[model samples]
Target chain A: MARLREGLRVQLNVIQALTSRELMTRFGRENIGFLWIMVEPLLFAALVGIAWSFIRGPVNDEINVFAFVVTGYIPLTFLRHSFGRSAKIFVANSALLYHRQVKVLDFIFVRVLIESVGAMMAYMFAGIVLAFFGLFPFPADIGVLVLGWAIYIFFVLSLCTILAPVSEVSDVVEKLVPVSIYVSIPFSGVFNMASWLSPELREILMWSPLVSGMELMRYGLFGSAVTPYYDLGKAFGVSIVCLLIGLILCRRIRRTMTVT
Target chain B: MIETRNLHMDYRSGHVTKHVLKGVDFTIKPRDRIGLLGRNGAGKSTLIRLIGGVEMPTKGKVIRRMTCSWPLGFSGGFQGSLTGYDNARFISRIYDKNYSEMKEFVEEFTELGSNLKMPVKIYSSGMRARLAFALSLAIEFECYLIDEVIMVGDKSFQDKCKEEFFEKRPDRALLLASHSLETVQQYCNRAIVLKDGRATTYEDVSEAVAVYKKL
Candidate 1:
């Protein structure tokens, strides 16, 4: 028990150190460095929000189509940002492995954390801004909304974990991940809710943890205003399985990889 | 003490698998200044890397009871975009050492002056070596693994290093790998020579140096 606690402490120490170093490397100490994490997603959300508002003009007073798009868009933007950053991560930071204590998982986790936190901030900030303009409504239940976001973030992180290490070895994988991210965007339930689809289509789509996670978050935002179709057990089960496989891959790579 | 239990490491490049360390075993107790003498590609650095837990041995285990420093004078671990100070700060953070204290030592030891503020990628090889050496010394590792090419820079810098590192840390265990026989003889009380993926330790440094000369 004591050893486990000590190990956790050490791991946390390494992560904290890497986090600051990575921040400096990516953003630097210059003007609005870290804030850019939020901007990429915010810009995408803003553009989509505008397009949707123009097209639909809000079906009813209760459903703010712009708010719907922003909420859905933020997670998609996060997924895109994460996959974009995953390709060169291991090779670029392979040098840091010389420290012996800094694990490859720490590098993956730090980026996930940066993107997740950034996306969350952008979500709330976009909501506040859009609400100010009377184009959005606040989350009806913050707790459920956050729970849904956490599960979605976990799902995305699991996918990233699998992709990050694989990309390190295969150039083919590196090229394919970014393109796949764009191709999979529409299918991830970012633009439309599950209710918009027929029951058979919804059942098929919910098999994807990403789509199911999207429904849960949207449900949190709209409350009784919209019906959410998601299998909590299925979504969580898939994420946990992916997460396990990803962790095993991470460990396998550490031993097999040479610190060049 | 640090002990290796029949450690074996194989490196694969395409279809070729190079057997680096084959069932090599040794134990390093406190204050043992053991020089690692091997020709180029004789697996001196590879052994050091395994001992430091930077890489895994294919078929055996390394049991380290004492803290070991990463191969000293190695700059590959540094993030190139960070300044020298930031690099040092990163090490301090990982090791949980005091940053300001490490900063003072680095500034004084490296003598890179304002160059420490510049991104490490811009620094010359010599400047990088100084920062790397300084960062390693800042942490209090009981055992240190020195890479062969660490004897860099001018006479004064070398003298400062010997005075600060060698003379100061009398009781610390050291595994120094150098091509220079004189360096191996002067600093080490004993030595280990490598050949054909096997290691043979010599109780006398001169004997090890003599054996290394023939190989």
Candidate 2:
């Protein structure tokens, strides 16, 4: 018990150190600084919301366009931002690993954490702001929304852990990430709703853990305005599988790392 | 003491692989001042890194009961955008030391002056070395690993380094890896000569230096 407590203390200290370093290097003390994380997502969501409102018009009177877009786009943005940093995390922080207390897990987890909080703040603040303009309604079930967001974060983080180490060994993974990020926009469960599709199409999309999480989040917001198709069992199962695989992969990365 | 057994490190680039350390076994006892001698690619640095736990060995174990400092004067640990003081604070956080105390030591040791407030990328190489030296020393350790740290800066700076490290820490253990045989002979009581992916220990520093010169 004493050993576990000491280990936790060291881990917490290392986490704080790495987290501050990451934040300082990324945002610096310029105009707005770290506020960029929250603001950037809002901008992305708002821009897409406006575009969709212009192109498709109002699909249903019960649903707000901005709320629909915010729910999807902000979550997608979180994944993009998190995975984007995960790719070259080793190269950037490898020097700090010289400190025996600093581990590969610290770097991977800290980046995900910063991005996760940023997305959460952006999602909450966006809803309030959009509601003021009558563009979005307050979530009917904040509890469910939070739960869905947490699960999505878990799923994305597991993927990030895999990407962080995989990108180190494979040039193909590096090339694939950027292309996949762009390609995933439509299928990201952002602009598209699972309930809007045919049974076969919805079943195919439901195969994606991201889509499942997205539908859950959408249902939490839209309530009776739209139907949400998701299986919590499936989302949790796939995420656990990915998390285990990612951890196993990250553990093996030490063997492949350059000695000096 | 920090002990290692059958340590091996291999570097892979493209289709080729070069073995750096093979079955190298050694222990860093408390207060042991050891000089590491080897050729340019002799894995002197690699051995230090493995011992320091920066990188894991391919087929061995490193059991460090004693805390070890990072390769002294390694400037790579600093984030380019952060000021010298910020980096120091970050280090203090990682080591669970007091930030104010680390800053105080850094200000006195680095002599970076106002440069401590500026981004590290703008500083000269000498300034960085000084900052690295200050930060490393601020965090006390059982063992200090030096990898040709004296090669940087001018002669006076080198003298200051020798004084701060060799003179100040008389009882602290040190593993100094350098090409300068004079420095090694003067400070280290023992030596480890690395060659062909293996280590040979010498009780007499002069003997290891003699063997190192022939290699």
Candidate 3:
């Protein structure tokens, strides 16, 4: 018990160091610095929301287009950014492995935390701005929204964990990840509602952990105006499976692989 | 104490497999200053890296009971965009050392002055090496694994490094890999000659240096 506590303390220290290093390296010392973390995603979501407002007319009669876009794009941004960068993290931060305290999992954890926090702040910031203009309403189920976001974060983290080690072992997987993410967007349910699809298609889509998360999030955000379809059991099961696989793969790679 | 048992490392590049360390066994105890000597591809650095826990061997295990520092003088650890101060703080935090003390030590040792506030990418290779060396010393590890001779800056800087590693920290263990027999003779009391993925330790530094010269 004492040893476990010590180990946790060491890991926490390492995680703090890694997160700070990541922040400094990414944002630099210049104007605004780490604030860019919040700004970059905000700008991306805002631009997409404005463009969709003009093009798509209204995503739903009761739901505001800006709110829908913010909800969809912000979470997708978190997932995409985290997963997109996961493959390259080992190679990019391989130098840090020199310190025995620093582990591969620490890198993934830091990245996930950064992306999640950034996305959450961006979502809230956009929601506030839209509410000020009377274009968006306060979420109907904040508790459910928070829970859904937590599940989505869990799924993203597990996916990233699986991808990080796989990418280290195979160059092909690294090359294909970005393209795969782009291709997987429609299936991710970021732009479309699950209720819009036929029962058969919706059943198939809900099996995807990301789609389930999106549906659950929209359910929490939009409430009774739209029916959200998701299987919480399936989503949780998928996330756990991915997490276990990722942990095993990462351990095997760390044990057998040499950092060049 | 740190020990490697029958350690074997092999690098696979496509169809080719290059054996780096084969059945190399050694132990590093407290206050033992050992020199590792080998040819260009004799796996001296590889042996140091394995001992440091930065890389895993293909066949055997590295048993580290005490904390060991990474291969010093390797400048790849620093993030290019972060200022020198940020790197120092990061290292301190990771090692659970006092950040202010580390920063002060690095600033004083490297004599980087205003340049310490600038991004490390802007510094010269020599400046980077100085910062790396200073940070390594600040951590105060039980055993230091040095890749080669950590030559940095001018004559005064070299003297300072020698003083810090040798004069001040005489009791600290060192496992240094270098081709220069003179450097090994100066700093190391014992030596190990690595050839064809094997290690032969000599109690007398001159004897190992002589064996290395013959190889």
Best by TM-score: 1
> Per-residue CA lDDT of candidate 3, range B1-215, in tens?
99999999998878999999889988999999999999998998889888888888899999988778887755556777788998899888988999999988998999989999898889887888788888889988889888764643577777897899889998789998887677789989999999999999999999998888898
What does DockQ give for each predicted structure? 0.77, 0.60, 0.65
For residues A1-260, write the lDDT of model 1, one tens digit per residue: 99999888888999898888877877776747556655655677678767866886757577777777778878987888788787767777887888877888888889888888878888888877788988777787877787888878899889888888888777899889778987887668887888899998888887678888888888888888888888788889989999999888878877878777
- lDDT-better candidate, 1 vs 3: 3
Candidate 1 lDDT over B155-207, as tens digits, reads: 77778767766789888899998898888888888899999999999999998
The global Cα lDDT (0 to 1) of model 2 is 0.83
Error of 1 at B86 (Å): 1.2
Candidate with the larger DockQ of 1 and 2: 1
- Residue B122, candidate 3: alpha-carbon lDDT: 92
Per-residue lDDT of candidate 2, residues A155-202 (tens digit): 989998899999998878887887898887766588878878889887
User: What's the lDDT for residue B193 in model 3?
Assistant: 94
Candidate 1's C-alpha runs over 4 A off are A53-60
Flag regions of model 2 displaced more than 4 Å.
A33-36, A40-47, B73-75, B153-156
Kindly provide the TM-score of model 3 when superposed on the true structure, using C-alpha atoms. 0.94
- Displacement of residue A237 (Cα, Å) in model 2 is 1.0
Candidate 3: fraction of native contacts reproduced: 0.72
User: Candidates ranked by TM-score, best first?
Assistant: 1, 2, 3
